[model samples]
Target: MSFPCSDQSIRPRKMQSASLPGVMEAVRCWCGDVCKVKEVTDFSDWLGMKFFMCANYESDPPESISTYVRPPSPPPLCMYYRWIDTEMPDWAVTEIRERGRRAWASLDLEERREKAEAEEKAEQKK
Candidate 1:
């Protein structure tokens, strides 16, 4: 699935991240904010899909978020939405997926550590 782009002027800008060597930098939204990658893990079909959204969508004033869902409302969010898992170039998508996997692994490790600590505390109380 692809998000609607109302503004043709704003295009996706490729960027590079030094910390995430394999993953490419996030694309910039029409509103000039960097796009954020949202991980999809809800369904089997959409699992592992990383979609990009305007980083400013949830701003205090609710700026730049796409209103396309409701036409006749207002200008759609900044023209900066794409599926990195599918739309991105092959090489870039591969790197991005790898990065996502690594992130998930880190999170899993942290959760395990927390669980272990909680178990140890419970045992000490007994």
Candidate 2:
């Protein structure tokens, strides 16, 4: 599916609702912040695939106050990267670095809390 947006860079597409193994439920950064989902428009090979990237991925560093001063360096990347359109085997754990693993653990706790709340609400209605 396509969305009506002024930005010509992004081309959106419909994705399946079902969760895929090895695919994150919610894309997140190594710093435990959520990542943004982006669509590829320029790369012909990557077109139609949904990718996750750090929220600050494309941001530029702030400008210097003085003409002679150099701008401060950009913040370090969280290294949160993933492809939402593909699935991988469970053994793919080996591919995740320590930071990614920590982020995933945090994500797991969040998911568990959400599930428990949903179940509790369901039980209340019965």
Candidate 3:
């Protein structure tokens, strides 16, 4: 199926029925703090998935986020989580996995190129 903004496979975000269309509805965590709506942008099958996350939640430090922001994350308060959208279809899952594979491979190539360039610079400095 197709959507006006994105593919049907794209994760949907929960929002207030009465509020603005794009405004996300507030979801409180176990601690009564409003949870943050986050999207999985990493190279994985779950990419583009939207979920509610506790502000104090942490999976593995900086690596948990695709483009991690550095500010010394606070201790996790709770592990509350809820998916906003339904699970993807089999074809959608396969497509996402393939995209993720290509993305990872591209990143590896870029890293290798940068490393080689750095080595060249070091040799020139010697």
State each model's CA lDDT, in order.
0.57, 0.53, 0.59
Better of 1 and 3 by lDDT: 3
Q: How would you encode candidate 2's per-residue C-alpha lDDT over 4-112 as one tens digit per residue?
A: 2323244333322233335356655666777677644432434445666566555322444564685566555554456665533233333345547889999999999
Ranking by lDDT: 3, 1, 2
Highest lDDT against the true fold, candidate: 3
Best by TM-score: 3
For model 2, which pairs clash?
1-14
Tens-place lDDT digits, model 1, residues 51-72: 5667755422234656665345
* TM-score for each of the candidates: 0.37, 0.36, 0.43
lDDT of 1: 0.57
Query: lDDT tens digits, residues 8-110, model 3?
Result: 2433332212211155576777878887766655545555556666666654434455544666656667766666645544655887778789999999999
Global local distance difference test of model 3:
0.59
TM-score of 3: 0.43
Output candidate 2 Cα RMSD.
Answer: 17.1
In model 1, the worst 10-residue window by lDDT is 12-21
The CA lDDT at 11 in model 1 is 32
